[model samples]
Target: MNLIEHLKEDVRFEESLKACMNCGVCTAICPAAEFYDYDPRRICDLVQRGDEEEIEQVLRSDTIWYCGQCMSCKTRCPRGNVPGELISVLRKVSQELGLFRHSEKGRQQVLLMNSVHRNIMEIGYCVYPDRVDPDYHPEQGPIWRWYHEHIADIAPKLGANYHGAGPGALRDISEEDLQEVRKIFEVTGGTEFSEKVKKNS
Candidate 1:
């Protein structure tokens, strides 16, 4: 199938994009648009126009990755188009086709896979407190370094279980529960999708 035909196969493409009147409401409300050079209105126009070349270019560019998937555009769209959701579809297609590796932002999928996704499968939490090492995540800064050094002491004082027993913040998830999480990922194609991102990146 052609690129447009492949895009149409995704249910998100149908649900997110109806018609874009170019009113620019989506662009106006998009946080990513404010921060980055992204224009949700223009993206909608391009997808609506169904130019295969342009769509392929979008799949390969940082434009699709710029969307934070906040879905603010969905709330104010005059034509009821959800540009953020459309970006989701575009990102998935890009990963599937290995086109995401063409762009700098898209290549970060590997890091996401190794970090958040991997953590979810192993620990049953996307961002486990122990996993956020200050060395790897220097962006967390000196305060985080202090927190990391003292988390075992400070966590309990703040009412967190830390690495201890049943039920509460930062408590260890049971092995049975972790197995269930892995099963869910396997059944829902999350594992397959992560593998695709790894392969493509």
Candidate 2:
């Protein structure tokens, strides 16, 4: 099928993904693949086959949701396949399919993304959902705080730079957006965990 026609229905696997070696290295490290039926290798394989039916089922499966997009798979994939990016593509398709507009977790994820964009856009980085890390030590705090306080330095480590500042930023977030993230965190208990991480940091 042509690109336009494919976009109208199922997401094409793309030639880049068809290069997968099926070495299972991705599964060896995947936290979700180990426990769930989802496998990055298989997902890539199905996408390569243009098996829209099974691929659609895979999209809704916890497989897509459980992917952390850590890029560990990407960095390690000898074939240069980006499993994380593929998952993001699947997720967008999932949303366009009206799959997420109905699910509770999907609703929560959308809420979380809005909150994160708002907070980081204004604050650079944040101790979001405000959850503290119990394992936090004075020498090193949890990932969020460490990322927030020194984003200029730590962000590069995470692969993205944290670049945003107050009303001067491109998008101005309202008070509602800030509160929205906190509320989401409240549901996720991120606030409590953030406090713990920051205190130690």
CA lDDT for candidate 1 = 0.90
Model 2 local distance difference test score: 0.57
Clashing pairs in 1: none
Write model 2 residue lDDT over 17-91, tens digit each, in one string: 647768978777777676666588887777766666776666555557767777788777888887777777776
Give stretches of model 2 more than 4 Å off: 1-16, 35-37, 101-105, 118-201
Tell me the whole-model lDDT of each prediction, alpha carbons only: 0.90, 0.57
Task: Rate residue 45 of model 1 by lDDT.
Answer: 95
Task: Report the number of the highest-TM-score candidate.
Answer: 1
> Residue by residue across 85-124, what tens digits does model 1's lDDT show?
9998898888888999999999999999999999998888
Clash totals, every prediction = 0, 18
Q: How close is candidate 2 to the true structure, as a TM-score?
A: 0.52
Can you tell me which runs of candidate 1 are displaced by over 4 Å?
none
Candidate 1 Cα deviation (angstroms), residue 9: 2.7
Q: Given candidate 2, what's the lDDT at residue 6?
A: 42
